[model samples]
Structures are given as structure tokens and as C-alpha cells.
Target: MIQSTTPGKMDRLAAFIEVFKLRIAVVSTPHASSPGSPALLLAGSEDEGNARVVFRLHGFSEVPDDVRVVAEVNFDNEANPLMSALPDEISVPLGGSVALQATAMAFLSEAAEGRCGRSAALNRLAEVLMLMVLRSAIDSGAQQPGLLAGLAHASLHRALVSIHEMPAHPWTVDDLAASAAMSRSAFMSSFRTTVGMTPMAYLGAWRLTLARRHLKAGEAVKLTARRAGFGSAAAFSRAFSRAYGHAPADLKRAGASAL
Candidate 1:
């Protein structure tokens, strides 16, 4: 079934952003080239940064030469699915969109002013910039199979969003197909084609991703395992070690939070 292309289609994406915490800071301009170019650069790999966002602006010829805004952002989690699913570089030219241009100018002004709470304000602006870029990316779609490809699909996004919002819902192929409003075979075929993984496999990976987050925050193995729908700690540890090349305990930090 064809789904609406309107605004609410992406409503569930907000949950991912909520958990996908990132750090934004203003960094010095690395080099001077192509003034009048305002672009958003996303880090391609874990080495660079998972969800790192860099918005660099060399003021357009129309604006004063003094305005230059260069800021870098880093996402705290390496396992952010949104970043993992995207290509190495998604450049958004601010000049293309009137709304984006206005926002970029405001961001640049905020960064240059260094007023009270400048850091906080800049971070918020960076978020707006990131959101805009993400929307563009989702609309443009990806050539390869991944989350972006799946989300860009009208029917598939519903199931993907459901899976994302409730990773611990004990999802199955049939259930996921129902969520997507497709037959079991059709859903499996489309999901695998677009996401490059079977529905159950993606669910498992997503669960492990969340479990690792909790483990790194000092949550106990058994607690995380149970919450992740694992039968026992041993089973969970084996899967975790295979996926990350380290035991879950190795990720635990100094303090523990309520799991």
C-alpha cells in the first residue's frame, strides 16, 4: 500500500533522535577555501566520528567578508543507526534553500557574537542544521541497502519505525509484515532488499546495540540480558562478544545506572 508522503510520516523518527545523543561544539576553521560556501559535512567512519556534524561557512559574496562560521559536532555513540546507515558525506548547500540559508546566517551570527549561552545556542542551531540535512538525505534516498533506503520507502518506513521504537517488542517476520501492511513473504523480501538484513536479524542487532549502551553505562549483564530478551547472561555474552569482539563486561564504566 502507498503511504502518505506528508509530515507525519517521519513522526516516529523523533524517538531515534531522542536516544541518539550528540555533542556540538564550535571549532576553528581548518582552512580557507571557497568562500560563500556553506555546507554540512558528516563523518564517514568511526575513525572520523559516527554522527559527527561539521557546518562550515565561508560567507557568501553577498554577505560581509568578516562572517565565517565553522563548528564541529560529535555523536557520543558509535552505534547510532542513523549515522551507520548513511553514506560517508551528505553535503547540503545552504544557498539552495531559503529556510536553510536563514538558519545558517543565524547560526553564524550566534557563533561570532559569543554572547551569554553562546555555546548552548550554537549547539541548538547545529541541531536544526542537522535535522534539515537528515530530511534532505532521507528524501534523496540511498543507492545501497540500509536504514536510509528502508526509511525512504513509503511502506517499509512504517515497519522500520515500529522496529526502531520498540526493539524489545519480541518482533517476528509476521508481526513486522503486519506493521508494514504487507504479506509475510512480501515484507520479508522488501525488508531484506531495502535494509540488507532480515527483519529478525535487524531486530537482534538493534537489541544488542541498546544492550551495549546500557552495559557501557554500568548496567549488570543479567539485567541487560533479560531486558534484551536473552535467555541468560551466558547467551548474551556470547552474542555480544561475537558482535563487538569484546565481552559485555569490558564495556562497563565506573558507575552503574538503573537498568
Candidate 2:
């Protein structure tokens, strides 16, 4: 479920998390992770190139290779707007921070517990830890302008969230500026500087992204177009082809062929 948006206290990561359809599995203690295992220690997933993301663990064996938390993270890196905002592979160092060590150990304890709702509990814990790592990345700011840089900005994030929450809406620069409580020109310039794209470009990209997801899921062309902010299926197909180099109907045909 998408978390209810709170005024002034919103969860910026909520939308992306929903797209991930996150799954978690904890490799409890006594199973020592390989010390040189970089792939298992990173908090990212592989791009499996399908609607479903393969189960990829957020490797937590960074320090001392204690325990690893397996997670099916966001694999649709191209479609996910904020994927570039994070480091491709992140492994937070717990050796330097006592608080971080406590946080990591707490989750391990929960993994060890044989209680009711253990799986859900462990998933939630891993989500929190992963969020901490992503939050650190967001807080550190970005050298290149993109979703991370825009999200790190004080005002731009609000506007970005507006676009994210309502992709189907016909968003104008004025509308988005009002959402951010900024002048149209200021919003435009700042957004370009921070996100490296015009607002409309971002909106179009977001719409096509949603459209691609629908197509990949085998949704009808007209319905997908309508739901993804296109005026008609033809328009959607044109834009989708320009972006992804294939027609929307092609995915359906592929799925049909497979079936």
C-alpha cells in the first residue's frame, strides 16, 4: 500500500519502495558470509529485465561478514526514477559507527527470534536498515544533477513528489510551481539545474515509464495509455517506441507467444 502523504512530513522513499515489491530473507547467525563477498554485501539488486525482480539480497556482511539480509530490491533500474539517486552498490560500514552496529545487530536478533510474524518482522527490519543506507546517500548529496540532487534540494523534492504521486495528471509548470510554492521561472531554472531535465520532460518520462510497466504486465493498450497520461493509444505507442525502441503491442505479442 502507498503510504498516505503527509503535509511537510512526507516519506520520499515510499513510492520507490512500492515499485520494488520488496522481499527479504535473513541468513541468521552461524552462517558466516565470505569476507571477500562484494556482491552479497551490496544493498542493490540485479536488473533481470522482466516485470518481476529476481530475489536479490541486501548483503550486510560488510563488516566482519556476520550476517546477510537477502532482499529483492528495485531491479527495474531504468524505469525507477530514483534508481540513479543511489549508489549502484552500497554497503554501510558498521565498524566505525556504534549506533549503526546496534541497528544491524538488532535486526540480526529479530532474525534469530522464532516468534509469530517473524518473516514480516525481519522484512520490516531490513527495510529500515536499507532506508538508513539510502537516506545516507541522499543526505550526502550528488555530484551529478538527477533525482537524488533534486530530492536533496529543499523545495525541489516537494515538486518532484507531486509529479511522482500524480503521473496521470496534466501537470503544467505553473501547477508544479504552485505545488512547490515557487515562481514558475524559479522552479523551472532550479529544477533544470538540480534534476537536469525540464519538468515536462520528466513528466513525459514518468508517464512512459508507467505505460511500459502496464504493457509489461499485459495490460490493454488503450487502458495503459489512459492510465499513463497519454491522450490516446496511438500517442502512447509513438512515445513509448521513441523511448524504448519498440511498440507497446509488441510486449503483448511476446507474452502471448511465450504462453
Candidate 3:
């Protein structure tokens, strides 16, 4: 369930926490990274040598696409400490945390048993482990201009929550500034500095992202347009094409083809 602390009202840290939903995929040696996915690496000593686990996070699916963009902008085909750019082959030391060790063992046990009732329990463990990784990254002061930077800034967090919570709302720079309790000029500069995009630009990207999801879910174009805050189907189509390099109908067809 998406947290319901009322978007613009939550404290910065709480707001940040609400934006993640744990998604996990475990692989043995030689893990492959999924594009646009953030992950946590867990590694520890094994009987023979060492063991590793990859917890692939689809958490960004819960965040606005614009926010994801901020977190991912620096990502490239190179090694980086930032989670989004984390190398596929890196083995993160499972820092001697007993609680984490217990949780990891439990997850492995559940996976081996393949019990239906244990899925939720495993998911909760994955969420906890992911948080542990994120906390370590933040505590280490891994400076990457994205979600971490936005979360660190009180004002930017407020604006980000508003955007995430109400992508359908007709948000303007002035309104977002009011939400952040800052002057228009300060809000613009600070948002760009921390989030790497102007408020309106972020909103536009976010809305289009929502529209894409809706379309993929088989929502009609006109309804998707309205729900995504577009003035009309044509406008939404133009913007969607600009953002994603394809028309909504094309995406719908592609989704159908996949099935």
C-alpha cells in the first residue's frame, strides 16, 4: 500500500521512505543488471569462499519518473558507488550486522521451500535489507545529485512529495513553491540544483510517465490524457511522443504484442 500520510504533510525523511516499494530478484554468480533498476548487493563469507545476493529494486516504479530521472541521470556504462550506477559485478560487504544476517537467511529458506504463504514474509525482508543498503549509502555521504540530494534538502523534499502524490494535479512553479514554503525564485533554483530539473519540466515528465503506465494498463487514450493532466488527447500524444519517442497507440500495440 502507498503510504497515506497526506503527501505534502509528511516530514522529509518519512516522505522519502514512502517512495520505495521493495522488488527483489536473486541471482547466483555473474549477476546481470537491469536497466533503470536500482539494487542492493549483499555479500558475506561462505563455507568455501564467499556468497552474494542481488536485491533488484523496482522501487522507482513507485516514484515519479522525473524523480527517477534525477536519481539515474549520472548512470552510465561505468563503475559507480551510487546505487543506480552500481556495477553488476561488485560484491558489497555484508557489514557484520546480525539482524541483516538473520533476515537474509530467512529469505533464503523461504525461497528454497517455495511456500505460497511465505511470499509476503520474504518481501518484507527484502524491503528491510534494501533500507539497510540505502542507509549505509546515505551515512557514508555518497554524494550523487538525485533522490538522496532531494531527500537531504527539506524544501526539495516537500516539493517532491507533492509531485509524487498528485501527478494529476495542475501543478505550477508558484504552487510548488508555496508547497515548499519558499519564494518562487529560490524554489526554482533549489529544485534544479537538487532535483536536476525545473518544477514544470519535472511535472511534465512525471505526467507523461503516468500516461504511459495508464496506456500500458489498457486505459483509453482520452481517459489517460485527462487522468495525466493533459488538456486533450492530441496534446498528450504530442508530449508523450516527445518524451518517449513513440505515440500512445504504438505503446499500446507493443504491450499487446508482448502478451
Best by TM-score: 1
Q: Mind giving the per-residue lDDT tens digits that candidate 2 earns over 1-259?
A: 1333565544667666665454344444424443322222322212321111111133334433322454444335445666545655554656545655566666657766778887778667665665666666666668898988887787888777777778888889999998778999999999999999999999898788777677777789999999988888899889989987988899865653422
Summarize candidate 3's per-residue lDDT along 1-259 as a digit string, tens digits: 1333665444433323433323454433223434455544444444433444433333223332211011122211122213442222222344346666676677667756878877666556666666565554443332555655765565676776677667778888899998889999999998887767788887887677567666766788999999989889999999999877888988776664432
How does each model score on TM-score? 0.76, 0.74, 0.63
Task: Identify the runs in model 1 with alpha carbons over 4 angstroms from their true place.
Answer: 1-8, 30-67, 95-98, 112-114, 253-259
Of the pair 2 and 3, which is ahead by lDDT?
2
Q: What order do candidates take by TM-score, descending?
A: 1, 2, 3
Better of 1 and 2 by lDDT: 1
Report lDDT per candidate: 0.69, 0.65, 0.58
Q: Best candidate, lDDT-wise?
A: 1
Q: What is the lDDT of candidate 1?
A: 0.69
Assess the local accuracy of residue 48 in candidate 3 as a C-alpha lDDT between 0 and 100.
32
Q: Report the candidate with higher TM-score, 1 versus 3.
A: 1
Clashes of 1: 0
Query: Candidate 3: which stretches are off by over 4 Å?
Result: 1-22, 27-40, 45-124, 131-144
